[model samples]
Target: MNIKNTTSIFVDCHVFDSGFQGTRTYIQGLYSELIIKRDLHFFLVSSNPDNLASIFGNHSNVTYLKYKYENKYLRLLIDIPQIIKKHKIDFAHFQYTVSPFKRCRYIVTTHDILFINFPEYFSFFSKIINTFLYKQSAKWSEIRLTVSEFSKQKIHQHFGFSNYEITPNAIDNVFFEDYDKVLIKNEVAQKFSLKKYIIYVSRWEPRKNHQMVLKAFLDLELYKEYELLFLGNDTLSNPQYNEIFSQVDSEIKKKIFTLKNTDFNTMLLLLRGADASVYPSMAEGFGIPPLESVAAKIPTICSDKTAMSDFSFFEDYYFDPHNQIDFNDKLQKILKENLGTDFKIMAQKIKEKYSWKKSVEIVYRLIKQNQ
Candidate 1:
């Protein structure tokens, strides 16, 4: 096999330290696949190199670089450039956006321009800083890669550029693994005190549209038949959660429960055992939870905007993200319909359609072309 420009590729693995779930999953999947490729050398840089190294090490072509800084912005502006030049890297792939200055040709993954589109979701300081960095990376990177076609279009609309490629996110086969349904279901029910539950599995935040999900559940009176299981961090520190919680009556509040920092297998079991899975996010880059739910062979309802549409094929599975009436009707329909076979077929197609191996291959080829 002929490989073009056998130059070392530097990947910023700082995402591990940031505690962002979706970004970490994307980078970890790509990092795992890329390490196994034969024709390229990789420099994995992070403040927590030991953690990443334990996963991506044991390969002759992969080198681990560490930087000591507690602050993300300081590490990016100061530490990353110094490390890139010190290693003499030819191409650097930033898992998020790029540093303002560059020592080499670089590629950036603009996951989504959510801050630009929904500025209200972020604080004023965060919005100002992130918008500037995102625009710069989109404007100046050697190659811009986004997770979904929807994001590519949004980036173009926001940044006035269309020179980017869509690399798309994929589900790991771990989600598709066979498990003892009876045993796992019993365990999940006991742990969460759940009985006939419908699940929502994402970080609780405004952009996730948790308020709308709660409102719809309350309006439809689904709480009478099924409890709502929230399967992620409660994020109590976020003022949004407090505001939403204050509006709920104590009776309605008792029906909702949150389980934070769940183990991966347990989370999968919850999805598998759910009567139905609902993902009502207002925006997303690739919408992993809906895909995970579908992969678990659960009847899945998703917001009909952004990349959630790519995960669920049936029209009945989607509802307007902004409208509670649309969500309630769809949620009712999914529960009322016999859709198990339909969900299984869609899961098989989604599994085939999104592959980490294929996504990494595209990234590899792009890196070679730029090199």
Candidate 2:
């Protein structure tokens, strides 16, 4: 388990971005921790050179390798083997579900098996590629890591891989640190002109069940004084998202604000200042935003389904994702309650359970053990 002399570990860094969502945040946090701890020399192979540089710039131990491919199959079949051989990588880790080359020892983080469960949401070609790649990756990987017990079970049931490890995804420690709450609240309120607001941070996809949130918000007469902020980009890449955005009622749309391309600090300020954070998704691998809200001492409402229930910090705060009436009733109760005591207690508990340093330490241990 000697990791000190390991030459380098190549990472599939396609998800490295600055938007502060789940996958990008996971990779960025892990990369930052590894660089600081000197766990191993790291190299990122990705199609987006700009994102690689944006995320890893000025880190001495990290290097970026440009990977160009017209499709995932081409990357899997052609480019990856060349990069591994040329760089002499001791091990390779894929952030996504699939890995391209299998020559060296490999570890993969399976965030969730969404594609396997919801094939209709993906194209026929994409579904095929994802299914094949996941099965192959599970069969070949020296170690497998998943974010939650729910996801671990799903992976085992679907791919029949029994040797996988669990490393729960966590929030950055910086989010849990003390900040000038009054100042941040004032600044965010002024910037967004937000008087009273509830926040939902996720991509506007069908599975996210944003329409349910929207419907619940519209049903609440109490929400007339408060704005519903949807803080994530809405790329037209998902047809369902496009149709939902297009068909939203004019009155509801007026009360709704969609903010795209927000940075981590701004998002932290917003979450910290909000009255409550709501996420009623139909599915999730491991819901990170609600975890972040818990860390930030914001009252959070999330679906009682999938890995969302596995987050131990917010045990009493889940609602049915399909029951808009129930959601609205809960929202009303949250709006009326004094959340300070409960928020502080939950925030402290979350700080203990979910930390990037702990996550990286587990990952490093797993890698060293396999090495």
Candidate 3:
């Protein structure tokens, strides 16, 4: 299968080692399609090549490579460059950060400059370091890409070089499939002992606005009927969310549960079984969970802020994240099963516009043109 003149592409798949995040979804979704092309060969790098193999399955054009060093800097400075040279890779793709030293033609996707815009949510050291590193990464790449128009604008406005292309995230096909709600709900209830619940799927951070949604659930008294599920891993410290959670009545607190480190399928099943979903995050690069919830036909209330503003598709369901009253009103409507917009119609529009198939085609064409 060594087709001569095939373009060789090296994908930095370290995100696979980190579970259940947007970057992992993006890499898996995009390259899952890209690996099928006969004229292109993919070298996917991660700490766990066996796990990567399991996820991507057997493909002639795909080769899974393991990292020699566990440290990110050592892998970037030493391991990745060695792999690029050994494989004679024509292009290397990275998320956010890239190797400072030149090796071959490089492509980078800086997902967002959120820290620069929402400096209050970030540490001073983080903001200072990322501002320089992210700018350098974008500057170093042969092609620069981002997840949404909002991110592209932010990158352009701040970074000033302004050539970043948009590679928006797509919903996984599983979310769109028509599953029996009764059957799924029964299975979810039996497996997890969750009778009725509302979910917020995101990695925990200050900017994610977990407290706002948590407060709304209590004030709206939806907790009386449904459990509030906080389903996400802790990335950044969200002390504000905790302070509010700590002050809640113990009886009401009993109805709240926090879940972390759920595998992809488990997350999907839980999401599909929800009474409703709320994405009240104050900041985002390209918010994926709200769309996923909507695609699963879950009644969803999304925050109309930052990058999420582009998701006008949520229509009347979009509410103010900062306003507790607005959050509560929207949450109450969805909890009462008042799905304002026709979700089926909205979901179709999402499928048509945002898909890995379409995204990969654009990326492939761009690569071919640049090459």
Q: Which stretches of candidate 2 lie over 4 Å from their true place?
A: 1-5, 17-20, 37-39, 47-57, 69-74, 97-99, 118-126, 235-252
lDDT of 3 by residue, 1-371 (tens): 88347899999988877757889988989998888788998899999999999988988888889999888899889999899888898889998898776788888989899999999999999999999999998888888889999999899899996777788899888889999889999998899888899999999889998989788777778777889898988899889888988899999988898899888889999999998899999989999999999899888889999989998888889998888898888888877775635788778888887999888887898889878
Best by TM-score: 3
TM-score of 2: 0.88
lDDT top scorer? 3
Put down candidate 1 lDDT per residue, 35-113, tens digits, no spaces: 7877787888777778787766677778887877758788878888888888787888885578776899988998888
Q: Model 2, range 104-127, lDDT digits (tens) per residue? A: 888888888876787665568877
Cα shift from native, residue 224, model 3 (Å): 1.3
Q: List the residue pairs that clash in candidate 3.
A: none
What lDDT would each prediction earn against the true structure?
0.80, 0.76, 0.88
Clash number for every model? 0, 0, 0
Candidate ordering by TM-score (highest first): 3, 1, 2
Q: Kindly indicate the candidate among 1 and 2 with the higher lDDT.
A: 1
TM-score of each: 0.88, 0.88, 0.97
Per-model root-mean-square deviation over C-alphas: 3.1, 3.2, 1.4
